[model samples]
Target: MKLGLKIKTAREEKGLTQNDLVKISGVSRASLQLYEADKGNITLDNLEKIANALDYEVVHFLSSNVVPQSKKTCPPICPSIEKNMSPNMSLNNICEFIENDSPLPPTQSNNSVRIPVYDEVYASAGQGFINDEHITQHIELDKGFLRSYFGLTSFLDLSIITARGDSMLPAVPENCQIIVQKGTPREGQICVTRIDDELYVKRLQKRPKYKLISDNKSYDDIELEGENYEILGIVVGLFQKIP
Candidate 1:
């Protein structure tokens, strides 16, 4: 059965309604409905939340038997674990596997890719100070997830940078790390832009005139009519510690 069906079956067996699941799982009602209907690409974090809410082992949800229908070939978050998962593995085993950040097994290491995390700062809601680019670390991510989710042939164009300020507000919160895919910005997409000496993370707008928009209304939209600016890249993903 599909992962969604498995979740739905487990929820039903628990004698809880969708609303109950929402309250217990802390997952939005809309997302729960989407997962049940198999219309969404549920993230690993959200999947873990749902599994915990139902008091079920997360491996049970991630097993090959319950593969998500959206991406059949794409392995779940950690290929190191998913590739070796067994029906008998407990949740504690999964945790232990994660705490030890060893390289993927020799056979699967080739399937992993490293994306750099830069120490440069960019303002999501305010003016960003320009600094020399320095790579702080490298994070390993599944090659398939990058290709399938971001539609990128290679991981060289991707970099992670820290976002600061509240101008972007709830969308890109202060201190959050943003994954930027180096490329041209599309209209209405959140992008990293450099104007003169300052850097910014804002939504790109090109309809009436070239502008950078902030989600927070208190921050004024930047008109780029005659500014010396360059579109660094678009914000493709965000990484933050789960509260």
Candidate 2:
């Protein structure tokens, strides 16, 4: 039987509706529907929660069930990837990759093929900054090239933002490659931020008030607030191509 069918059967046998299982398992209504319908992939953590709530073991859940079915699914793909991906990637459109027998390529096997590039800051390092409304375009580098520098081949969870200005000079040049980690931004760390209507690559500092500081003293620092700005991602790694 399919995983979803098994989950649905287990739930019904225990006299639990989808509501009852969600309340007991803490899984979302949409996800529960997927689980019962065999729609998409479920992380190990979530599967564990459902198993515990349904009074079953992870072994039983996996050993007795099958993967999601292709086609005939509502909306055709699962929406689970939405929260974990950048604009260039579609959370619901990664099913073809899962079904493939081949291994993922270096830097991007399945979801790693595209790395998004945000705007450029020109004032830094004597380059011109360019902004685009449609900035979610991705860059595809050679698979072997990415493997040479990074141990992990997949850059699935990372995003690339541009350093347009020279504010982070000497360390990060203008038009520098700043790979942002997709999660909460930390203070005293380099972050790609959206300040109201504008985007910036700056270092976040909590000096009594929220503010972004520039490493290049020639440029001035700007004060910020949680409401006015959003942290796009954290600067996990920096890259530069050999010219």
Candidate 3:
């Protein structure tokens, strides 16, 4: 059942109207209405308010009809999640327990932080080629490796983009994976940006419009007229793939 219907059902079972719920929960009427309409997601705090008002626990909604990934349906991970677990238990219970108890066991499996690797776009590190934007996959890189190699403090601010062509050359090599961060750059800072639907890793200069520059002398600077460009991310660190 939709979360909204569940909330509405519980509230009606408790003999509470929307006005009564808003008065008891201290949540705004519009927000309560949105929750009932199933328009969007709500925070745990707000969920607690509504759940308490309806005399039901938050997990009741979850465990009642929760399926993170169904075995006969969409579970590449669910089927192998917990083989020895009870059949009566649903995925929702596991999640509910995890939620109530913060900080899951820090397994070595999840110790390495994950960063998204984009296959479609390439920074012009070698020769120039245009590609579409897509996230090919994600890899859990060792936090120690990231810290040692890039002096990075947080994985939350990092992503991996493959470099293709050599417009960046000596500074950025061709066919390398570069770490990117979304941040406002100083003028002349090397950044990963997009123009005309093509992604590029280039030095940026701000004028009335934007100017994308290449480190290699062979490629001329591309003047981006009007608002036809976007700053995707700044190059933080670079790595080579071992064949």
Candidate 4:
């Protein structure tokens, strides 16, 4: 049963009217009505208030069978390519080979395959060839190798792109290439953001309100609310090509 329905059922079983529950819970009457009608779209704080008022634990209103979405798994590295890799091979060279060569299908093995690096392509942040943007680089490595090399087992999908704008300077200078990963941004995590069609890379802060911070004190933090902003991705790594 949905949480709303469960809450309504429990309240009915306790022989409490919505108004009585509101009085006990200190929750607004409209909120109590919403709860009983199974339309409880409330925040965690409000939910706690309702639970306290009902004389029931918060867990009692939740479905026991709820399962979270599984984390996406990385494709296996190709053994055929692994055999040819030399100890002296740099990350750039491996990327080149993966982009240039065609190998076995991903379903055949647990080996690494190259993930194509396409240009800008309207990524939710970072810099790249905008619309007709071309591929500037291709990174190839087994997921295991990348995890070991970066010392980050929690890394998700990684995409290479150049940084744009002076908004996130000093810490992440313009033109610096970055590797972005798909995941939730923790407080203080540097992330790429999409705010009303504009992109920015900034330090993220999540309070009752969201804020985008910059290392340069001159730049003010951008507060985000409603549907105007979203976190595109977290920056996991950076690289700079030498001439």
Candidate 5:
């Protein structure tokens, strides 16, 4: 039987309804339905919880006898290339693989590419001295280039920058690649800011007065009004590079 059918059988044997499983498992009602229907991926943690609730070993719930469907085949590898290439190849080698596979050049398209920039500065960087005129070389990019560079949506005008300080850590960590969109700040959006000649990244909390909050507990919140700050751009995503 399929995974979904197995789950349904198990639930029915236990005399439990989807709502009852939802309450017991602390999973949402929709998610419980998906689990029983086998329409969604269940984490190992959730699977364990479900097994415990149903009084079964985790493996017992799976269809061990069922065989998975076979995948479609691809072309055979080039023996010459395979023999010459190392098991551990660099990014350049991977790009060369793409180049060899297709007739198109890599740089033909203008897409947004993730470029590493300086880390954000907070605390010591005053609002009065923040400078927007900081000269930096920005390369024009295409969607594919941008997506490959930052590992983000290829169609969006997005680029990644590393966070320099711990002010936004836990949520936005230091040295994390923060995805930025060049646009006006919406209310309650996370953004990069320049104030008093210094640059910082914080979530923009607009109440009766504007406030900037750091995700890290060590950093204090900042309040600004009038000319104290300017929104550089809104932050849409973030990621960390594993060494």
Candidate 6:
């Protein structure tokens, strides 16, 4: 469920009205309504207050899939993630427990993270691909390698998607796997962006006005001076088949 729906469900289950929650949690009624409706960007502080008021942990609303216990008993990586012997924690839980915490046990077999692969979603190099939620599989990457090579702070910030077409040509060839990270996009950074529900992989440039620049000049640049756009992520790495 979405964050707003989760909050609304929790509130209804607790039999607390909006006014009651506002009084108890000290969150404004308008803010609470917006949160329950899933409309605005909710802050961590607000979420915590509402969670505490609803008599639940923040994790309860963060992930639908709870951490499952491993059949084999293994040493705990950290105190926060001891509920499961193996790394069976949900994506949200893993991020919650691991971000800025001590590194996990240095066993080669265990020192890895799983990044979701959008098999059906392509960030087009020539044209735009319609964005979707169809995740076909996950790619496992070495945690230390990501941290050292890409300077990644959280595993949750990564995603793997396919790059289609030769518009990005020399730098990002067609049919290559792109490793993108969630961050503030800067000028001239190659990023995945969405406009009118279409996804595109292009380098951002500000030539007095913002635009999406294609490496292959044969393709036309997308002007974003007045068009609404969303920066999905910045391209950090790529994996191409050696054929």
Top candidate when judged by TM-score against the true structure? 1
Report how far off residue 242 is in candidate 5 (Å). Answer: 1.9
Error of 4 at 65 (Å): 44
Better of 1 and 4 by lDDT: 1
Predict model 2's lDDT versus the native.
0.53
User: How much does candidate 2 score in TM-score?
Assistant: 0.41
Each prediction's Cα RMSD? 12.6, 17.7, 19.7, 19.8, 16.2, 18.2
Per-prediction backbone clash count: 2, 12, 6, 8, 19, 0
Q: 1-243 in candidate 2: lDDT tens per residue? A: 556777887788679999999999888999989877778667556777787677554434443212333222313123322211111112122122122343323344432245544432222222212234423334443333345434444555555454445667766665445666566667787776665445566788987888878787887778886456666666665544222
User: Which is the leading candidate under lDDT?
Assistant: 1
lDDT of 4 by residue, 199-235 (tens): 5678888986789888767777888866576666787
lDDT of each: 0.62, 0.53, 0.58, 0.53, 0.49, 0.61
Pairs of residues clashing in candidate 3: 125-165, 125-166, 126-165, 126-166, 127-165, 127-166
Model 3 ranges with Cα > 4 A deviation: 1-111, 121-133, 207-209
Give the Cα error of residue 167 in candidate 2, in Å. 0.7
User: Which stretches in model 4 have alpha-carbon errors above 4 Å?
Assistant: 1-113, 123-138, 142-145
Candidate 4 has what TM-score? Answer: 0.47
Candidate 3 lDDT over 1-243, as tens digits, reads 566888888788778899999999988899989988988566556877776676554544433223222222321211211212111111111112122123233332433665554432333442112222334334445565466656777667567555557788878876555778777777888887665445677888887557888888788788887646667667778654222
TM-score of each: 0.52, 0.41, 0.47, 0.47, 0.41, 0.49
lDDT of 6 by residue, 71-155 (tens): 1222222222111111111111111222223323333244566665443343345222223354433334656556665677676
Candidate 1's C-alpha runs over 4 A off are: 1-42, 47-110, 120-133, 147-154
